[model samples]
Target: MDLFDRLQEQIGTVRLPLFAVTVTAAAQVNTPLIAILHWHGFRRATPLVLPGVEIPSRAVPGSAIQLDAPWHSFETVDAMLLDAAWQSGAWDVERVEQRGCNVIGASAAETLACRQAFGDYGEDMVRDPQLLGDETDRDGLMQLAARRGYVRWLFRPVKGGLWRTLDEPDDTLEVDGGRQPPCPVSPVPRRPGGSGRTVYRLGKVHRILLPR
Candidate 1:
């Protein structure tokens, strides 16, 4: 099966009556993902953590983040374009919109965003109805989130992974046979006259042979 199908099976069946999936690179070529959750009627978001999951890093080409959103939030989301925050790498971000019971949404986010967004929703700081209450402008809040570090809201939706990543392109740019993990540093060619211990980059860590 292709990568998407496996993810569907691994992700299992969710309770959302309707949801949308978009394809975005998780990181440069084969790095892990930086998924985020956007709940309806809330201005902020939390990490989209898929617990106890182990699949090939390549199997997850794009986002695995799930969002439980209301109609407004769902409609605002586009498959081609998605919401994401910069962490260290610039890659496409996949967003899923789930509308159903038993799925995590705004109520949960109010607590989750306590340290991330502001303080608690109502205790330490007052909840902004315009940002969180009915018809919540999630995009607006995320756009405003750009100002804060540690966590950034995707207005145009950008990338990063723990720390800033190299300016290399993700796996999508390469052909199937050429796909490989991102090298932290670029490989320098051997000098014309110099020889001992030439610096090199490994495209496939598992391979025993060196490329000619």
Candidate 2:
């Protein structure tokens, strides 16, 4: 099946914890994210980590580390980080959203100012009503959200080992045939014929893979 479907089969209804990773190439700035809880409110102010490439002490003001190789060495670093996260089982796919500009963990006030400066540049997917009893769930999702640029809530629903993209563009992108995973049929909701209620199959949870 496609990558999304395979993810679904792995993580059932258990909502996984969110982990955010922001990278800055030399002079470039960092992008942050926010999280949304399945049954609670938003989360922010989680311990976000920054493990950048080790560059020579003397180099361009803002250039990321570079090494001469047949292919791009940076790609190797990225793969290593992704693999590490997958093994940790603490984080899922990395969410991508457009922040006003890349700003690393400068300060809470400064970050808030930057977010306010942007003023709704990206989509906000937090639609569930703000509940008060789910402190644990809210905390986890919020930390995940803070790490991303925009809050793209990653979810893997139950039934049908299918990986579905939520509010993100997946089907529109192009990819190499050899590298692309098999796409599976998305789960369908069962029809309710005078029944009190029917269960809709949500997708599964698997590792998130960002495009190169």
Candidate 3:
């Protein structure tokens, strides 16, 4: 089983807001190291600090995602409670923090490397500026990222009151009008009696399209 499978075992099918997910990542600095991806329109920026390949998010002062690694996994992430179930996405922060929120024992690092080295659109996608900087465009950053590694972290804030987490990305795999794309997501098998719990493994994607 890969990190995705192990993650589901650790934290059941609990769906959470994007904020909560980042906070949990902050708390878990060592084990199950995670690299966050903070999307900024067509511009890619570092997310809040954690560790590993650090970068700071331009959106929030701190935000980051690093799926481009091998050691990265979701294990340390435990759990927190909402003082009150979300109602229209409005609530008191003081009350919520007071009621729950595991301490961020450590913090993530601020990073711009992911954005700096690679172009905003990641057309370059080169990690090592010295060795492959010039050849990045032709060598392919996606392959370099693969050499470094990558894991697709997918989640829907509230799907049936449970956060829907998946191993792979599904947007491109679907077809609103035409037929499905060439590369379809490889799904992670579900355990016995598992309902509404499915994970799709990422397939090969050649381009690093601008993130919105």
Candidate 4:
């Protein structure tokens, strides 16, 4: 069984607010979603920090997402939370420290290298700067996030969303309006008799962001 299928058997349904992560060219940081998050009463900026970048709704000196590579070693559970924190910038170190977030005093230099080098997924969508730790292990982390209900929003740098409008990017993927795009990753299968759950072909590897 694939990772996605295995997760489906383990965890039934995830009840959490959709956590989204978005990275675009520096020019387009303040997109509609940022505004929308603000509109939804998310006054804090800590939730918007990702690896190598911090997307604060309102910039605050201390509220930063510190992307220390050594501190963030690659383990399935840690990787999931790291990616979620990297993607959504929602993790409060002070709050989640009880849940295994300990600062090991590593350098954010590795994190900076990733962002400066690729800055999210590069062309062909194969190489993401953030996925550098352990390519083989990412799937496990992805699955774990689903099992724990942390895989809320897997927003990539695609055709639309807040980034597109803000960047006015030329390489945006085109759509026919009727069909949705194919998922970036292959899906895991589902187990029989799963309640409140339907097996996704991509197996919920990426968080789905429904535009409201």
Candidate 5:
């Protein structure tokens, strides 16, 4: 049987209510937690953003965010989370840790399922280290996912102060909707071989246009 089918069979008929799945890090590091949750069809109804944590970092500094989901059962939720993490090349058995808890209160079954799933998946991930891609690429993909709304933008404070959103204005654009173009042009000086036209080179192609 497939992994999902096997997990379902092993979990039996146990069901749990809504719960929160949280992942903590020692420093501000990018992971695919949200993307994985979304891939598993889980919605992050409420996200708790904790800023200015005690994590130390020289380049980038930020706080950890706890994402909460109201899943029907821990077995299915854990299975999906594990599968998504594996597929997205984000599961790190060593550096990253995850936990789940009942949203309203605590439940034995839910907690057990969480621990069991973590142990099982964590081992599998370690056995197959190829599941993870390059750290740089993974971080880039996470940023792209956040920009596309596939995941919430959790970290704002970084090495550069705050991460800018896609909708934020760029420095090149002027308030009046007009600014100096990126290309540089020299006025056509009156000379023997000059056609009195401004010349600009664009990536290997030379073009002459009327000066506005």
Candidate 6:
């Protein structure tokens, strides 16, 4: 069976907590902003303790941190983000969304369930030996116990840059006003039984606070 099918099976039988936090910005300033937020305790305030796991001092400056906190709930993360934004006066943040389902199981089973649920996001984090810190790799089993939480941020400088019609090119020019090469856009199959219109999933956009 494929990963998603396995996930559906595990999710159906297990009783553990699985949550994800996604943050989107109007422009591509999410990386630095998130770093600043983490510096100010948005990342450290979580009480979810992983015995041997060492949380990064700061999230990777450019990349987002994917699901790595199984002990935390969606609501808990949502509140933390809001509080951080408020305290840091990061009015540029547009929206924050957290979602998770309950799937109970033993520690091992819980880890497997989260690993499957988070998919590639979890895999990338788990496979990184440096990210795993002092944890021993028992045939890659250590990853099973790691948290499957992640933070994703998106930003678009132009308000309607992403709203172009299906046939339009998907590339954006360089900030220096140079004629940048166009990037390829992948085509997605239309959903069955619905209108034949193409759909775009922009995810969610939220405002985040940055340190001055």
How well does candidate 2 score on lDDT at residue 15? 38
lDDT of 5 by residue, 1-212 (tens): 12223222322322211112222211122333321111111222235445864433221111122223334332333344334222212211111222223334546654443433222133544543322122223333333332221211111111111111222333332332122322222222222221122212211213544455
Q: List per-prediction Cα lDDT, in the order shown.
A: 0.26, 0.27, 0.25, 0.24, 0.26, 0.27
Evaluate residue 114 in candidate 1 and report its C-alpha lDDT on the 0 to 100 scale. Answer: 23
> Candidate 6, residues 97-193: lDDT per residue as tens digits?
1121122433554444333322223545554321211222222322322322223222221111212112222223223211212212222432332
lDDT of 1: 0.26
Q: Clashes in candidate 2: how many?
A: 27
Tens digit per residue, CA lDDT, model 4, 1-212: 02222222212232212223321111111111100010111334346556887554531111112122222111232233333232222212111111111125424543332232222223523522232122222233323322321211123221112233333222212341111222232222222221122221221213455565
Number of clashes in model 4?
A: 7
| Candidate 3 structure lDDT | 0.25
Q: Could you tell me the lDDT of residue 55 within candidate 4?
A: 59
Give the residue spans of candidate 3 off by over 4 A: 1-34, 37-62, 65-120, 123-144, 159-212
| Candidate 2 structure, TM-score to reference | 0.19
**Residue 29 CA displacement from its true place in model 2, Å:** 11
Q: Count the backbone clashes (under 3 Å) in each candidate.
A: 8, 27, 24, 7, 0, 23
Root-mean-square deviation per candidate: 20.8, 20.1, 19.7, 18.9, 24.3, 19.1
81-138 per-residue lDDT for model 1 (tens digits): 2211111122433222211112244355523432233212344234232122333233
Query: C-alpha displacement of 143 in model 2, angstroms?
Result: 22
- Model 1 clash count equals 8
RMSD of 2: 20.1
- Residue pairs in candidate 5 whose N, alpha carbon or C atoms collide under 3 angstroms: none
Q: After superposing candidate 6 on the true structure, give the runs of residues whose Cα lies further than 4 Å from its correct spot.
A: 1-70, 95-212
The residue ranges of model 2 lying beyond 4 angstroms of the native Cα positions read: 1-74, 95-212
